[model samples]
Target: MTARERQRWAVLGVAAITASIVATRSLVVTDRDRVDRFVDAVSGEVTPGRIDAAMRYLDPDRQPVEITAYEATEAYGPGEREALRQRVRERLRAAAGMRFRVLRKSVTMGARSASVSMQLYSSEGAPSAEYVLRKHGDDWLVETARLR
Candidate 1:
């Protein structure tokens, strides 16, 4: 190829590589972002129904992450629902509007599935919990969460 043609090809190759990098990064779900999404759903104004809405962020179909009790929600009594929502809200609120750090994170990825394990702490440095997340249809869902 001529020098001019070689330059053009090099430019196109660089562009393609850049695009591939961006696409790969976008497709890989970060555990920190997963917890952030969960916080977003439960952050503002705790409501009885909000817990159920936040539950949608969880992927309960996978083993080790799925618990039957959480799996069979949707018929919670008013008081029970409110209590759950309040507890979640309080946890986030206590951690300064959910401003926290992922103390540790690990990810295992497949072509269309992934698992994440993470330890989190509040901004003030209190242990929050260690949990698992699973990837589902371009979204990361909480498989399990526990308090420390």
Candidate 2:
């Protein structure tokens, strides 16, 4: 083969590899966005009276989990989780008439599981907390949460 032909093939191979890398990165970003949307829907749009909406994002078989805050750790069951959601709604309503804003979200996908880190701001416009979400099958549930 001619040197020019070999050079052309090398260039084409490099271009193809770069394109594949870009496409794969785009897919990862898209999946992360999906997790972000779910977090946004829970923290931004959900309210006290509409706390049930948050359940859609949680795994159906989600168990009670412990959330460690600055100086305390609280274990929450399904009912307590609902109550916490309501309290969040009420606090949001009393503070700003809306839910908190999600500052950032990072999602990592694994072979059979995934983890998400979400930074949430309080309705009072202060740093509220960071929640770690775990994905089981198609559902994402809060596994641990801590205040920033």
Candidate 3:
């Protein structure tokens, strides 16, 4: 190849490698980002009958094992997914207009699971909660949440 042509190919190769590196970095999902996204979904606005955003972050097979204010301690099984959604809907409706803020947070990551402990501030109250998430395929789903 001519000298100019060889240099052009080398530049193209470097460009390709740079593009791939950028794409790979963009695709890397950090555990902290997952927790942040979960908080965003849970704290998102919910319409009367639509809670799709929050539901997307939750595992359909599991529900909050314990909720202090609700006095619910028993975990809902897979069959109760709909029921859990309904409860969340009701709570979301009741909490309408209340702004939720994450006061502090800590994330612990495992091979296939993660735990997020956070203190939340809302107009109604300040509560501390821990959420357990399990990685499924390329997504992380909230397996259980303990809210106090």
Worst 10 residues of 3 by lDDT: 62-71
Q: What is the model-wide C-alpha lDDT for candidate 1?
A: 0.54
Q: What is the C-alpha lDDT of each candidate?
A: 0.54, 0.62, 0.72
How well does candidate 2 score on lDDT at residue 85? 57
Better candidate number, 1 or 3, judged by lDDT:
3
lDDT per residue (tens digit) for residues 34-63 in model 3: 767876776534454236766777656743
Best by TM-score: 3
- TM-score per prediction, in order, is 0.41, 0.51, 0.74
Residue 65, model 1: lDDT of: 45
Better of 1 and 2 by TM-score: 2
* Candidate 1 Cα outliers beyond 4 Å, as residue runs: 1-56, 59-87, 110-113, 121-124
Clash count of each predicted structure: 0, 0, 0
45-105: candidate 1 lDDT, tens digit per residue:
3454555667666433432243222234232232354454455556444444344456675
Show the colliding residue pairs in model 3. none
Q: Tens-digit lDDT track for model 2 on 1-148?
A: 9999999999999999999999898766444565666665667744543455555554324755556657777666765756665544554455444566677766676554456666777655555565566666555676666664
Which ranges in model 3 have alpha carbons more than 4 Å from their true place?
1-5, 28-36, 44-50, 60-70
